[model samples]
Target: MKKFTITRILMLLGLFLISSGIHSTNKESIFDNIFTVMERTSSAGNLPGIIDNAGANRGAGFNGRYVFVASRQSGDYVYYWDVTNPDAPVQELNISGIGGGTFTLADLTAIGNHVFASNMVMPGIFKIYHWNGIGAQPSVLIEYDSGTARLGDAFTVMGDPDDFAMIIVSQHGGKSFYVWAMENGELNFDEPLVVTIDDLPANANFSRVTLPDGEDEFPVVSGPAGVFVLGEDEDIILTIEQSFFPGWPMYVNIFAYEGGRYFAFMHVKDNPAANVMYVLDITEGEDVLEALQILKNGTFAAKVLHSHDMGSIANGNASVSMDVVIDSFGNLWLMGFAAGNGFVVQRIGDAGPDGLLLPFMETFDGEGEDTPDTWLPEGWISFTLDDDGEEFNWYWSPGPSANPNGQMRSQSAYQDDGTWYVLNPDNWLVTPQIYMSEISGDEIIELSFKIGTGAQTPGFK
Candidate 1:
């Protein structure tokens, strides 16, 4: 036997391997043949550049080049990081001394050069600080002591970066939502604009909304609806109510206001009746409908979309709404959970089957299913190669190493030479859209028996 090491053998075979490559190296770009690994430097496992401590990081927002971190109410420090080199992040500053009393921390958001911190304790004031993007610490610009309405839990900074607006949902024992405008180094109003159901555009569609079982006495009116403003004009709102009605044990209502009309985009009445309100009067029919209702503007009726569950996983039960984000293009991104899959994200724009979406462009966290495939977290298909309308072997999979039995993968996958393979992209799993039939008044909408897409509703559900 000849004396040879593994290194020598690999070096000698390199030429032969290149000669018989899978794709032609002559035509392919360098990027096509290269793979890059992202090395993360974090104070915690999930959040890079954040300190791993006992207190949870409540709120985080970006202002130009800095990433600010706001700790929970118990935490005494608020920090920022310089992410000029994302691969290796550097802690820039840590700020404490917030809240008028002890044990009261802050939640933060930034608009241009201003960082706004809201604390519910004492002064019950929202503080705005000057962030010049040149220094590590922020200077207190102004503080608005809005009576006793504590801008506590949830808030979002919206509109253009230079002249932005904030929607702060306060929970000072009673819930309230407020919109505050900001520009240059000041606030445009003495107080934030309060959002109310009365402010919603009056339309005929409100009469058509129905709750779970049938019993309805106008569900509980909670304060401060989850609110988000799109651009300078459109405002979106989500509200949830606790109900005793079997048909709608809980109701999630999504409303949007644009061009003088408030459209009810979705009303997901959770039919988890037996789980919450046990009533013997509802013995005639099914227990859970858990359906999604979608509506279009100027339309009088809403369509009850399909019903499906991601089931329970190790992490617990998941819903059609897990998380939501808006892209720079202004399209909404919906994230839902799956039992076997970690998270599934989808974009919502132009209505699929329901004529509800105004051509917009549109993921997940859910529990596992009753009979989840292979106990694997990742499944589904990803497109690889595309040549105009036609494609070749577009399905991308982790192969035998990551998914030996091809768990949670598509039914279109097949076995080849003892290894599971994904040869077809036609049957790739995508979020289901509402499609209407051409039959005029007899409108038939096709819903998914398994996979589906709906609102990543603003509610905490």
Candidate 2:
């Protein structure tokens, strides 16, 4: 009787362990094919020629080549940088003579060669300063003095400035927002269209008001409670609960890349370590509503494509601005700036589902022993979580003493003249996206691979 009882307990324990392992794997696999990774390419703070005003950096804007950063003080200046080589950004221009009356320059947004900055000169008196391009003299595009509404806490511009553009600005600490239209380089300063949202948290200052180009009908706003999509009737069409966010949502934007549409936002909290920037793939839906609906239903864990730890770089009000730019080489990049944290540039990888045909195989047949160390087969990715810069990644290796054809290989560490040098290999090699749509309900799939190591000591996992 005792032996039988012990055996039963052991069996139950084994089953529980197996169940836990399966659950963990399933949770991880859900994000495997849906999200991309935000690899930080460059970041710098307090560089020469750039203002180093901590906690005063209010906003940033990108016009293809240049990234403009503005300080939120009466006499502070707006600086621009040329990040052609993200690794080494060069400060190009700085404009002064901004800010007056009650508030200084609060935020900025750029489209094409045109840049716009906002300032609330006095109570209910808001002015938008326009620049044709960097180094161009600023002109007052629109000045409205009405009610007790406050503008310029956060704003965004949609459409092409060369053709037609619409500027959306939020009333600070209020539920109402204002919009203006510009066509053929002419501004219509006529009475602005004011839309008021219902159930907006009291004293909730909008951190961002984004209207994706050509999607003016559905505008998105980020505030204290969460991020919301406002419909034509000023109703909250969709809501991304604040609980889903890592911190208070401060900035949000949408962009398209590699035939995929993505939504990204930066959040902040009292603990700077809690701050993070997240990106999600919205390409599964045909339209904005459909994409957002999928995201709302899928929950945060399932839809998040990427997350970058902001660390202690941002805190306090944590006013941040982000913009997406496509380089001349057609690579997509996300540029971000926080008042006290400076700026960061990350290259957006193509991690969306490719829906490639089934039975995919990568034999690494074309690789030779002499292949360049940095070469990687198309669609394959290699990266390391550590910033130590010892990126000794997996490379093509001609098999030893067996098959002549090459195979992918990685070395844990190396010994030089009796001295053991630890590489501390914390790396990942990801395969290309594969289609899994054929797997139906209750279907089982298998992934098989051959892995071996030349060393006697254990390394590969």
User: Which predicted model would earn the best lDDT?
Assistant: 2
Give the CA lDDT, 0 to 100, for residue 384 in model 2.
27
Model 2 scores a TM of 0.61
Q: Weakest 10 consecutive residues, lDDT, candidate 1?
A: 273-282
Clashing pairs counted in every model: 29, 0
Q: Candidate 2: misplaced stretches above 4 Å?
A: 1-54, 72-74, 85-97, 121-124, 202-204, 212-216, 272-274, 327-329, 348-461
In candidate 2, the residue pairs with backbone N, CA or C atoms under 3 Å apart (3 or more residues apart, or in different chains) clash, namely: none
Question: What is the per-residue lDDT of model 2 for residues 1-461, given as tens digits with 9 covering 90 to 100?
Answer: 32222113223333112111111123223334432222221132233334344456667787756677766544556667655434344543345445463656767777778888887543666878888877687777877884776677677776666666667777776777677778777785566777666666544465566754334456677866787887655667788777776677767786555556668787677643444667777766656676788877776767677766544554565567778776555556676665555565565333333423222222222123333333334444333223443333343232232222333343233444754443433323335435555568898654443222332222222
Misplaced by over 4 Å in model 1 are: 1-56, 63-66, 72-75, 82-84, 94-104, 111-114, 122-126, 134-136, 167-169, 195-461
